[model samples]
Each structure stands twice: as C-alpha cells, then as structure tokens.
Target: MIGNVPSDFRLPTSDSVIGRLADDVVLSIEDLWVEYQTPAGPMQAVRGATLEIRRGEAVALIGESGSGKTTLGLALLRLLTRTARVSRGRARFRIGDGRTLELFSLGGSDLRRFRWQECAMVFQAALNSLNPVLKVRDHFIETARAHGRKDDRQTSERARELLRMVQLDGERVLSSYPHELSGGMRQRVSIALSLLLEPQLIILDEPTTALDILTQRAIIDVIRSLRQRLNFTMMFISHDLSLAAELADRVATMYAGELVEVGKVRDVFYTPKHPYTVGLLNAVPPIAGEEFTPLTAIPGSPPDLLAMPSGCSFHPRCPYATELCVRQAPPLFAVGNGHQAACFHWERVTRRLDVWEGAVR
Candidate 1:
C-alpha cells in the first residue's frame, strides 16, 4: 500500500540502518609491506597488511606505542623517511568523485599535486608539521595556491571558511604564527589547513594527543561534525581506543607491525575475538557503576621490531596461546560478517574470557 520510499530513506543492513553503498572503495591497500633500514639491520615495520577505506566512513588504526601505526599512516601519504621503503604491495587511493589512482605509481610532482586536493594529512606533533616562520593565513594560502587557485580574496575567504569549519576564530588564528598558539589551537589550525582543499580522505596521526582532555573532546567533536557535513572518509590513527571507538565506524588493531584484527567498532570493543584486541578493551576505564571486576592486562611487552618473533608476534603476550600460536602464525579468520581476527585460539579465548556478557546472535 505504500508508494516509493523517499530518497533519503533506505532499508536496514545487518549492521546499520544506512546500507553500505556499492563497492565504492576510496582507499585499498593490498598485501602492504614497509621496511626501514635501521642501524642494527633492516626492520620490517608493516607486514602483509590489507585494508580498505570506504567513502564516508571513518576507520581507526589503534595499538600500543611503537606498534607501527604512525609508520603505516606515513606510508599512505607517501611521506616515509629516506631509509624506510615500501618493499611490496599496492595502495590504491581513489577520490570520492569516482576518480581512481594507484598511489604507489605516482611521481613526486604528481603526488605533491594530489596531496591537498585528493588527500590530506594532519600529522602528529603540531610543532614540527607547521612552519614556525609563516602566519597561519599564509599556510592556508599556500595550500590553495599550490592547488592552482590564484585569487587572493578567494584564498583568504576559503582559509577563513576552513578555520570556521574547525571552530576557530579565523581573524585571530589567521594572524598568529604556529609558535604563538597553544598546542590545542595549533592542532586545530593544522586540521583547518588539512581541510583547505576539502580533501576526500584525511589521514590523522595522533592529531589530538597533544591537547588536554577538554580540548581533545572539542577537537574530536569538530572532526565528527565535519565528517557529517562534508561526508569525507577519515583514517584516524591513535593509541587511545576509547576515543577511536567513539569516532570510527571500524577499528583495526595492530601489534608489532601486523594487523591482528579489524571489525566494526562495537564488535571489536564489546565482542573482540583477537586476544590483543581484548586486552585493549579491557584496559579502557569503565564508567562508575558499570565497571566490572579488575580487568586483566597482557603480561609481556610487545616484540621488538628489529627482531620480530617467529610465528605470531603477540604469542608471547597472549594468554590463550597454544603450541600452534608459537610455531605457526595464524591468518586472519572470519568470526562473523565484517569481522576478522588473526589468532589461533580465538574460539577458545572467546569462550573463556567472560568478556562479552551477551551472545553475539
């Protein structure tokens, strides 16, 4: 009896009410491997990694310090160090307007041109990323100018609009230099600059780690609001699982240099299959009253990248590890739709952990 549904309305998915669009993958990394020539020896930082960042979705890369999250992020922007090299794999980055390109094959000039227009990065450490000599206005102007927009008035207006988008005072922040602003303000400015070109994908590497609690919340809110307004995909990298869970639609857990698990945020946090992912969720401070008994922390430290362990890197720390975990590395196995984990004892651990109170259904 009902007529055609409204354009905005849609059928529900097994996951969310808004059904995922057709394969419109924006960024695709297949079998990626990045290695750095260290003083001791050549060390692999990212090993056999595969991920996809769809348009309009926010994905988080989370792990402990030295987990190679930053290194992998830098690889995406093709900003790796001199000694670091992408040994294998291809990262296919596509813009939202249906233009697809292979990032690995891009030349220096072509890559530079695509940086601000197709993709942008909000790097860690605002102190080093921004130019101390230039005013914030000039920084934004350079972004616009580099992308080939020559009008001064248009550039200024665009810069102000971007600043406003990140909830900063355009006139005041524009006039100030990077050294004059607080850490939070500097981060906000960096974010504003990243958005100057309205890039389809924004890669944030610990973008809020320098700010205080209040400022961190504000910055996160701005990111969420901007994503909703602009509908651009984000690849947010952070060590903070709680914040990542809040912002990202999907979460990927990295250990040493390998992706151990990746799945929906709720599934990873509430019903984590990977032992490393379980440890991370257990460490999050729960709200008062909703707290369970003192949670368990992983026993051992992460493996050294210079000499990664054979088989599973996390086998030393994983409690449910077996002989197979020590002798043979496990490939990512599907536990549910859109959920995968690299662990041998996932079944046994999921049953024994007592982490999830409810059944997955």
Candidate 2:
C-alpha cells in the first residue's frame, strides 16, 4: 500500500503525471470470469479468478500458456479482444482521489479515458505495436494528444525525459524508426511509453520474453530501478517462476483457469502447499555448481476448457488424487496464513510432499 498524494499535488489541465495518487488497495478483483465466443461454444478462459493487488507491490502471476494469466491482466485493463468478454466479475480501481472507478463497468470511451491516467499495461511484444514508419517521438506525441495534451512542446520534453529515465538517448530514439532500434532498445521505448502517462498500476505481461540473457538482465535492472523510483504497483506475469521470483513480492500459481495457490514469494518457493505447485518448483533445474540432481516434469497436458473434467481439473494428473477429487470440485481451501490451495487432499498432500521433495531435491 502507498501513501496518499501530497496536499499540494493537483491534476494537470493537460496530460501529465501529476494527479491523485494513493497507497493501499489500488485494485480489487472478485471472481473474474472471461470467455471467448467460439464457433463450437463459449469457452471460459478465466474461471472465478479472485485477486487483490495492493499498492506499491509486485505480484507475479505464474502459469503456462493458456492458463488465463494474460487474459486476467487484459481483463483488469478492460482490454480483452472483440471475441473475448468478461461474463461475470467486478474490478474496482481506487484512484488517487480516494474515489473508486468500477473498471468492469467502463465503456470503450470511458475505459480509454481511465487508462494511462490511472493504469497502463506494458504488453507482450509491445514494441511490435509501434508503427514501423513513424519516429518514436511521434508515437509519444499521439499518445499525449489522445489524452488531451495540447502543448506538443511540453509533451515532447516529457517524452525525452521518460526515454532518459529508461537509459535511452532522447534525441537518437526520438528521431529513429522502430526498426532502427534493436529489440531491447525498442522494448525500452515501449516501457518508456507506458510510463509516459505515469499510471499508478502497470501490468507487465512477460515484458522480458524473447530477449538474450544479457539484454534480459539489463531490461530487468532498468525496470527494478524505475519501479523503486516511481512507486507504481505492478502485476508481473511470466511462465518462469525463477525469473518471476526476481521481481515479485508474492507469487500466484494458476492452473487451468483458476488460481490454485498464492502466498509470499519465499513461502511459495520454499514451502509450497499445493501438489501442482510442488511439481512446478521441482521442475526447475538445480543450480549447476550444486550437487547433481534430476528434474521432474509435471505429467500430462492442461485440461481442455471446453470439456473440462467434472471435479478438480488437475486430479487427472495429480498422484495424490483420491476418489473424492474425481467426483467433486474442491474450492480454494485455506491451509494457514494467506496460503490457499484447491485440493481434496491438502493435508495428506503435505505429507506425501516430504517424501516427494526428498526425491526431487
């Protein structure tokens, strides 16, 4: 949670970072279910996804592709595609003014207005969203003008400052086309553009994917420093739990469409409570310098949402699954503290894990 905006702070007449900013609950999401209208039938991409992202914290959403992590992020921003829509859910955003914006209720124009001013998303392959023909500065200029900034001169200077904040040269980047910059440089430009509006919450959807190791490190470092300086809350989504651990304070594991486990990063990593989570952590390779060890793969593929299993979606693959797990879907059961898991065998699962953990580690 963050402190409230200072008394002297004010919303600018034009597009500027100065606005109502507060700490505490930035966004609250309840039972968010997003679906796609397919030719066969409606497929639920996100099922009863409930989460809360506090202000000034980094919460990482970890799952494989099609686990609904990306869909949930887009839903928070109300940016899901035409084929996809939120069937049922509520997302409330607490702006800096101590008022709330019901994010799920906003229409297209209202959503556009709310975005960037209150929240922004640094999308996957965001660099590709940039125009091939337009210079980088033109992109910033248009984003500013869209948000009602009249002074091209002031927006231009702010754009340059944002570029510098991301460690890119303002003059060179402003004059260059998207292709003129390397992938990492273009990604930096995308990050800078997202910050152009000074959004209170930034949804980074695998922003580090597809980059070389060295480039990834540089980008990660830049993001870490920027987050500390700017003090915006974040939802960092990734498939690599090890990589997510670098940036997140907490970790939420999604299986199929629902969150099967969530807790502090250290707790989730070192003392996972879910069988699926145990499988995930054990799947990661041990460090090269350590004693030689084997890695275990989580058996079977993810379920088909169109024809999901009757009970727990993971019971088919879970070794500890019992007959009850096969017949009745388990709700997210609280173990202790903030940790929760959806399993019929949460207690027995823990005991089996000791034997399992010894084998894997």
Please list the C-alpha lDDT of all candidates, in the order they appear: 0.81, 0.82
To one decimal, what is the Cα RMSD in angstroms of model 2 from the true structure?
A: 5.2
Error of 2 at 254 (Å): 0.9
Which pairs, if any, clash in model 2? 1-24, 2-23, 2-24, 20-96
Backbone clash count for every predicted candidate, in the order shown:
0, 4
Please give the lDDT score for candidate 2. Answer: 0.82
Tens-digit per-residue lDDT, 1-361, candidate 2? 2245545333322322222324487888889899999999999999999888898989999998999999999888877899999999787777766756678766655577678877888877856778898999999999988887878899889989989988999999999999999888888999899888888888888888988888888889989999988998888899888777788888899988899988888878877777888888777875667687676677778899999988888887787777888899899888768788787777766423344433321
Worst 10 residues of 1 by lDDT: 11-20
The residue-level lDDT of candidate 1 at 170 comes to: 93
In model 1, how large is the Cα lDDT of residue 231? 88
